[model samples]
Target: MISKQYDTIIVGAGLVGLATAYQLLKRRPSERVLVLEKEASVATHQSGHNSGVIHSGIYYKPGSLKAKNCIQGYMELIRFADEYDIAYELCGKLIVAISEEEVPALNNIYNRGIENDLKGLKLLTKDEIHDYEPHAAGIAAIHVPQTGIVDYPGMANKLAELICQSGAEIAFSEAVLGINEATSTTNVETEKHSYSATHVVTCAGLQSDRVASLTDRGNDLRIIPFRGEYYQLKPDREHLVRNLIYPVPDPKFPFLGVHFTRMINGGVEAGPNAVLAFKREGYRFSNVNVNDMVDTFSWPGFWKVVGKYGKTGMGEIYRSLSKAAFTRALQKLMPEIQESDLVSGGAGVRAQACDRDGNLIDDFNIVRKGNVVHVRNAPSPAATSALSIGQYITDQLFVN
Candidate 1:
């Protein structure tokens, strides 16, 4: 029996889901909204596991959804943080091109930043690079003044509290197993109970494809989990990184290469190399799920990705296995950084979507069918773009 009917039912309690819920209630305070999370607490997955760097919208292509949302969301996020009294720092970040070969990509990123209407974006000379990061070594760099850091978990928890205060319900540990759409309403089935909703919005990160399939089975997109392994700098060595120091990423790869970020909670993080994960939630080499592995392996898109980027993929595996290899990548930016200065930190699994032809989606991908809307692909800048993405999704799904 359906226990109750909500005006809207949101799956996943990650930042995107929470932000969407908050926006929905802000627009319609009287609406009955229910947010269901499979985890015991909010922001338990991608939202909490991230590096906590507030993206600057510098890397995204102009006129893309990512660019528009990230630019607007960056401002919105700062406003929300100020209003809610969240601690954050606009400490800025440096995107360094260590070699001549990387200079072109760095220039392209700069051009994109200009096109995206970023203010105070400065191209730094080799000598100027050290002015921002005293020890950083690079042939060229871009100083993005808008980049910052914040406690996303703290922000998410606060948003959840506000959502609760708005009279919406957040049901923890309620894994939505199925969604059935009828003529009049959509029935969402969780492990313990079934509920109906006028509309359902799913921001399921790792399980996005599977959850979306429950509503629209014909979707060709699939989520391929890539585990990003990180290492924290020893307390004594934290001084090495003054702020966020990022390498000029390869255009071919969708993920930004391993770099350094100073966490809001203190300490520094380095080297989150993207390696294919056996399970959707796999955080370690040994944490494998047979079904998830088989599901990933069975996908033609997965094989296409492996076949095309086999060498790069193998390199990521090598970095994962060898701390020395990971350190060497970091050393390219900071020659003084040694493996001993690094200690094992946490890992975050990115739910990247791939098409049937094996093309990794480069931007946010969302799909809608009947009363159910699915956020199939949202990664990296997603945390930074949460509020804007929420507004967009809310407009698409709810706003007349």
Candidate 2:
């Protein structure tokens, strides 16, 4: 096998990994930073398949890593997009309380926005909501004028460009098999090569827990893949949404319900429901890998998830198989929307970490083993918070 040595080795070439590499290279230009990706090209997983929405850090609790990084990442991402000329828009999003019961939740979200120091956030009256999205059905709404979408794959590509220009190397289609953490360095063995780094920070995403296990620190948690299936509005129905439109999310479940997003490409997408995935990268029902399923089934964490979320899990499965049921849920926010208005858009698998006791890990959790740091849980806003998260990871590596 090809042998190499570097100052840092980042596994996974998704947005987070690329961002980590970019930030590390930016700090110590002479340091050799190597990034490895399993895909033939970059961003074939969550980073590329995401809704592409630039989060405003609204949903996250104040003082959390998600909240802090998202706000900072937005600013950094804006600068990066401007620098690279990536097509993006700061066109706002509307979060609507569709019923009387949702008013308090709407207020809570508004307050969270305030705590996160968001500017231009407006809690609109029922009548005032019409001026923003005429077709939206709601009793009250919160206008987040900072929420936007961009090309994340493009962002990863741009970061890769920056890394290359800084003399760091990226090796794709190389899957990490083992990581031996030593007192002073980490030895990483991939499918095609072996490398040693003084320090290693992984953004493994889908295989995060597994990567951490290789470092001997992921014993307490396991990654459970949750597939988020999307649907795109037909061309004729593109005018239905001017920007991002959302419903007040279900509090019990970590999912933000079906919503509409106008992508940078000038088309609209809707309905990304969270369902349990059969495989780590299963985007569809037919794409099952027996080994993945068996591994998940064998894990105690997966059982814990089943015990806790059995009812919600069944509901998600029901909606996944029934088109009419899914449409009925979608109609809660957009009553005018018909089943025919949507077609299958791409799906993204979320690498959600569950504790041994079966509790879902909601925030960004990083645990270190020896000289290696493993990113255990980094879901939705990870791409949005890429740069800031990158900076944070870099800080953690050198600072601590």
Candidate 3:
């Protein structure tokens, strides 16, 4: 039996979900909204575990969803931060090419930035690179002055606060187990209670596929979990990285290569090697779930991905296991960085979506079935693109 009814019910209280709720209330203040989260507080997973970089829409392909949302969201985020007094900085960053082979890729990124209409993008020569980051070494680089860091968790929390202030309810520790879409309303069954809503939006992140499956069992996509591990520079060596120093990412893979970041809170963080995680939310190698592992191995796409990227996967696993290997990857950008200058940092799991044909979905995907909308894949720029994505989702929801 449904004990309560709301106009809309949102699953997951991460940045995207919270932003969705915020937008919904902002536009339709009279509509009843409820946000359901499985955790005690907001941003308990991917949203909190990120490196906190505010992407400048430089690396994404022109005309893609990631590029569109990121560029629009970048401006909206700055405006939101200023309005909310949330702490953030536009500290700028560099995408550096350590070898001559990387320059072509570097030029490609610059061209994409131009197509994306990103301003003040300066291409730097080997000598000019020092003008920005003195200790950094690169044959060529793109100085992206718009890239910076922010306190994402803080922003998420404030959104939640404003959501509640608007008379909406955010129920914590309520995990949605099933969904039944009827003629006019959908019944969402949770562990503790049953609720009904005219519409349901799920931004479940790690469990997005599972949540979507509750309504549409034949969904073709599956989320492949990849754990990104970080290492913070020792306090004494933090000065080596003035801002963000990134590598020319491997175009074939979605994971950005390990890099250095000057965090908004202070200090510096290096690395973030992406390796396959046995558990959906697993942070450590030893943190495994048999059920999650089975779900992963049972998928045909899993084996296909492994077969194609076996060599690159092995190298990332090697870096995850060996501190020396991780340091060497970072040393390509800053040669002075040694293993001793680093300390173990946090880890984040990315819910990368893969299809049965083994193609990794590279863009943000939002699909609507019946009255339910599922955010199937939202990674990296998702956080930075939260507000704009929220607006987009809101527009879709009320389009009729």
Candidate 4:
């Protein structure tokens, strides 16, 4: 039987929300916890469609939420995989610098890794680079042994299974329409039914900003969706990439440049250049949503981002449209790669947060408004840091 109120209600059944529910139920097994998801199943958006890279805290600033969570979550994720018999590998990765100009940025990344307390980080010479990846060509590279890959969607499904086994209800295909915060309880109204809870935690991914605004109308933050398109290497060409290979990212932008990733299931994936999406959930160039486009155009931060990174953005657009352009970018690290070696693959939309001032919010932005907690911004390492982020949110709920 459904109760009028639950001890806690979590919105969004992505990895973060599911992790939060799992931790909460683990702490208080008898507490009535319920999870609500707009999609018919969990991990349908960002969590399900990510690159599946277990980040090594190399790019994040020390002490930032991203850095801390990624480091702690990396350990927790490996441990959980071990206990649950999930398939994951510490295959490691190489952040290659093809030119002398890129060496400074590469050094900065190494320093960040050191500051973030990562062990077994090595600086590889041009000759030594081939030791790990024979096809990779670079002037210098940072070999991060902690970097790895896994089947994230598989992990998420297992989490959902565990959540149900632990006696929690996960209602899917129930889109959240509004949130009404009262003195003692919060009411979450969906398309089909309504749920009331003492406290509500929303980890809505793509619709995070909009869902958050349902409760607090004064929010200045908006979600700007960016589509990342990927390409998979033909089976015969998979050997060109051993483990994972990445370029030293530009310091000015938040995106990691195109490279190669050896998936846990087999085969290699390459090239995910970031581009503006026409829809909030837009996966392809043709998949356009008028309202989503209008929202993006009306946002001040969106234009500011376009103006600031226009050149880079245009380059990304070019790469997205031209297979040759994307292959050329990948060739920086692996010169052996040819255009014919690539084939169309899946794409994912990132729910990037931007402020009213036209600034893209970088860190993990979680805000607590009364009894409602909102995860305003969580990108790249979010999937890798879900457990830690969940634990952090779980801690906040205990104090309340």
Candidate 5:
């Protein structure tokens, strides 16, 4: 097997991993870094498949890692984009409460946004909701001026370019097989090569838990894959959404419900209902892996999650099978939208972390054991918060 040595070895070449390498090279220009990706190129999964929304830290709770990284990374991302000439837009977004039942949750989100130090937040009345999104129906709304969209794939590619220019090596299609930690160096064995590094950071998204378990045996968390299915509006129907229109998310669930997003490139995207996936990277109902299913079913937390969210899970499955049900969910936000207005779009699988106690971790869970750091759970806003998360990881490696 080919053997190599580096100052740091980072697994997974997604946005976060690439950003980590970028940050590392920026800080210590002389340090040799190597990034390994299972995919042929960067941003093949979560980082590339997301809605591309630059979250304004409005939905996350104040003082949480998600909030801190998203807010800080938002600024850094804009700066990076500006410096790199990547295409992006600050079109803003609206979170609407379609009924009185959702009003309290909307109010709470507004308060959280304020506590998170977001500026230019406006709680709008029913009439004012039309002022931002003319076709959107709601009892109340919160206009988040900072939320926008960007080309994440493009950004990921740019980071890879910058990292390579700075002398870091990125090897594609190298799947990690094992990680062995010695007294001073960590040896990482991939499918084709064995390498050694002083420190290893695993940013493996869907396969994070499995990768982390290679070194840390007592990992208490299991990654439960949830496939978020989306639909794109017909070309003629894109006008229904001005920028982005969201629903007041269910506080019980980590997912923000089905909504509409105006893509930074073009067209409008609707949907992304959270449904349990049979495969870790499964993007469709027919995509199933027996091993992945076995891993999920074998976990005790999976059963508890199913027991608690059975009804919601069934609803999501129903929507996945029936397009009319999905349309109805979107109609709550835009009354004029019809079933025919939407065409099939893409899907992304979120790697959500679940503990033995049956809790779906809501924060960015980064665990450090010995000289290795594992990003156990980083879903939405991760792409937006890539730079800050990278900087944070860099700090962890150097400081503590």
Candidate 6:
């Protein structure tokens, strides 16, 4: 039976979904909006699982969604955090290069930052780099003072709170099982019941492509799950990192390889190297779902994409198995970081969209038609850009 009718139904109660709901209610105060979450609570997935680094729009191609949205969203996020008193610190971050070969790309990022309207971006030398983080060692580095850390889960919860207060309902433990476009409205079916709405917006993180597939358009681009693993510093080693420390990312891949980041609450989190997750939400090396593994391997698009980037795939898989290899990658940036300085941390899976031609869609991918809007692909920095993306999605769906 249809549970209830709503003006809008948003699938996934992650930050993006909640923010979209909040933004929806902002303009249409009396609109009946319902938010659905597979989990029992908000941010149980990527939003809660990430390292909580607030990005500064670095590394994104200029004029792209990530560039524009991340830059714009960072400011908006900081303001929102301030208004709500969410624990956050603009402690700044550094993007460093250990070799002379990496210096060119490092400068490219610096220039990109300037073009993106990011301020206080400085090229730092060895001694100057030590002034902020004593343990960090870089031959040349780009210092971005705007990047910071936040409590993402806390922020997600607050967004949910404000959502409920604005008269929107968040229905948790409700997995979206189906999507049906009825005459005038779209019906989203959950495990429990059916829900009808005037418009439907989906922001499922790990399951984004699967959700979109049910709607018809997302089938062209399939979601490939890549798990990012982190390691937290022991209590004694918390003081080693004052802010965020990152590598000058390989322009070819989607993730920023294992870096050190300081969380809003306390302590430091290191790593988060991108590896293909055996399960869609696989946290541990032992956690494997056979069907999920078979499903991913079964996709022809996945094989095509993997075949095109076999070398990169080999490195990620190798690093995933060998801690020493992973440590070796880390030592390239900070030579002093011993493998023992790290301990296992939770993992977050990214829903990467792959096209039929084996190309990875780096930009934010959104499709809107009729009464439904699908977020086909929203990778890294989506959290930072949630508010703006939310508004963007709403405008696309209703505002034309």
- The lDDT values for all models are 0.94, 0.87, 0.93, 0.91, 0.93, 0.85
TM-score of model 1 vs. true structure: 0.99
Candidate numbers sorted by lDDT from highest down? 1, 5, 3, 4, 2, 6
RMSD in angstroms, candidate 4? 1.3
lDDT tens readout by residue for model 2, 258-347:
899998987787878888888889889778988878878888878977877788878887878877778888888888899888887888
Q: Estimate each model's TM-score.
A: 0.99, 0.97, 0.99, 0.98, 0.99, 0.96
Steric clash pairs (candidate 6): none
Greater lDDT among 3 and 6 belongs to: 3
- TM-score for candidate 2, residues paired by index: 0.97
lDDT of 1 by residue, 101-141 (tens): 99998999999999999999999999999899999999899
Global CA lDDT of candidate 2, please? 0.87
Ten contiguous residues minimizing lDDT sum, candidate 2: 213-222
RMSD of 1: 0.9
**Runs of candidate 6 exceeding 4 Å displacement:** none
Q: Give the C-alpha lDDT of model 5.
A: 0.93
Worst 10 residues of 4 by lDDT: 1-10
Residues 54-121 of candidate 3: C-alpha lDDT, one tens digit per residue:
99999888888899999999998999999999999999999999989889999999999999999999
lDDT of 3 at 284: 98
Tens-digit lDDT track for model 6 on 61-146? 88998888888788889989999998888888888887788899999989988888888889999788898778887888988888
Backbone clashes (count) for model 6: 0
Cα error, residue 120 of model 3, in Å, equals: 0.3
For every model in order, what is the number of clashing pairs? Answer: 0, 0, 0, 1, 0, 0
